[model samples]
Target: MFLDILLYIFIGIIVLQFIYYIGIFSVFSFKKAEKKNPNHVPVSVIVCAKNEAENVTRLIPELLNQNYPDFEIILIDDASSDETLEIFEEFEKQHSKIRLVKVENNEAFWGNKKYALTLGIKTAKKPYLLFTDADCFIPSNQWIAEMTAHFTEKKTIVLGYGKYKKIKGSLLNKLIRYETLLTAIQYFSWAKKGKPYMGVGRNLAYNQSEFYKVNGFIDHMSIRSGDDDLFINQAATKNNTEICYSLESFTISEPKTTFNSWYRQKRRHVSTASHYKFFDKAQLALFYACNISFFILAIVLLVTQHQWILVTALIAFRYLFTWISVGCGAGKLHEKDVVYWYPFLEVTLIFTQFSVFIHNKFSKPVHWK
Candidate 1:
């Protein structure tokens, strides 16, 4: 009877998560009607480069060529040990609006990226700021214009989608794509509902004043990451946060080739998850717990041969829920191909995330590129 009660409770939690996913899908579908303006607020595009000489040389040009009326590109060379600064200097010599800043020394208690961004933000001439990594390529010339359109609606922070460029004949490529799609769905859904908890730094924008208002990375200076999501979480109010899903505003980055590299990157990201607010933490914990619970329930049912009907029903409902929710999100992000890999992705995600949770709890600090 106790096991039955626990099973029912787990089933109920899964059902609730399923309902939450469906509700998000409905909201996203309804939000599809909102159109963006071509002429919007001016923006300052910020890129932080660390040992990315090749990326700075190749991708920085595309950012400078964005079809926006008024904008500046500020590149912060975060003590890079490569030709990253040299590349930026070459670009600066050619482009008038492109400025370069170098952080040679660690100032007391600031993380590398956050310190660089703080310098960039202070140097920015515009009120609006759009941030993307040096390794990412803007998909369209109108990227800045499309992204800035959201600010006209009084939004202080706008989170845009960052996807991986498609690479064939690689499992790591598919896994990275799947991870990107999954994150886009959750973050975009939450943003659309005016309940955003985090934003990816790779392609995100916010007001210059808002960053200062929240004291800007002062809270998480010791932690390596959170330059993007944590800042957004602190500054994002219901009236001031918006999400952009337009293809013109999208940015693409290269994927990690090896499993070890990917795992380390994800672990670094997950390390910051604990620093979020109570409600945000609860929501994420609940989501992960549901996934873990469903997996365990499946195993228990197979072993005990008990509550078979309830287990089957819950499993069916869970799959259907994930399909629609993740599918709708993928559709909005222009990643419909991810739907085909959802089943495999789901299983891997549950296992990997659990491992990440355990590893993060016990592992020492590790750096990544």
Candidate 2:
């Protein structure tokens, strides 16, 4: 009887979190672009590439051809071992707006990417700074114009979505898309409710002034891989952050092929999750705990033969709630097809969370690719 009561209480808590996510999703509408005067605000697009020779050669041309009135591309080669610098030199020959910056020696002050971004930002002559990864490709020519329009006096920080490209014969591609969609659901829903906690570094924008105001990751400098999210968490005000959902403003990146590469990348990311504020950490913990408890309780109920109908109903309710919430988010991110893969995705998420927990508990310092 005590175990049954405890299970009931856990079920109730999970239901409450389901409703909370739903309410958050329904409150703030996805951001849409509006017509505005052709104001030429000076803007700088910064991209840091380490061993991304092919991506730089291909994506730089698209960034240079943006329809924006005024902007410059600052490409930083972070001591890459590959021919990244050689490729950048070839692109710089054709485009005047494309400036190549190389970090030959680490000043021994910051992480490789952070150092590269700091160097690019220092040389930037614009008031607004946009950060994107080298592997990402912007969707449209007007992507910058559409994204920048949302940066008014009210909204200082902008978070945009990035999807993974679908590749045939690669289960890794499917998994990457599912992971991205799930992450977007949590962050986007939170952003919608003005309780923004995290933002993706791959496609994020903020003012130079805001960056300096937060001391530019001074608190988390020793820990790498959080320069984007930690900085936003420190700098963004309640009314200063906005999320962009338009297709024109979205980005797409190729997925890693091997599981080992993906595992290392995810492990690096998990280390920073603990650095979030107490309340934010509590919320995340509750969410993950519910998922784990649900799975465990279902297995116990099956073995003990305790109120099978009630247990099945609770399980169904939880599944329905997650599917709807995750489905809404997947739609907004343009991965609607992945919705059909939700059952497998949910199972995968549990294992993924367990891996993250173990990694955080036992893993050593990780290096970024």
Would you list the C-alpha lDDT of every candidate in the order shown?
Answer: 0.82, 0.78
Per-model TM-score versus the true fold: 0.95, 0.93
Question: Which candidate wins on lDDT?
Answer: 1
Instruction: Give the runs in model 1 whose Cα sits over 4 Å from its true position.
Output: 29-33, 107-111
For model 1, residues 97-129, the per-residue Cα lDDT tens digits are 998898886767334678778888999998899
- Looking at candidate 1, the ten consecutive residues that score lowest on lDDT are 24-33
For model 2, residues 75-187, the per-residue Cα lDDT tens digits are 89888889999998878788889888888766675345776778888888888888888899886887787668778877878888887888876766777788888777777
**Cα displacement (Å) at residue 336, model 1:** 1.4
**How well does candidate 1 score on lDDT at residue 225?**
84
Q: Give the clashing residue pairs of candidate 1, or none.
A: none
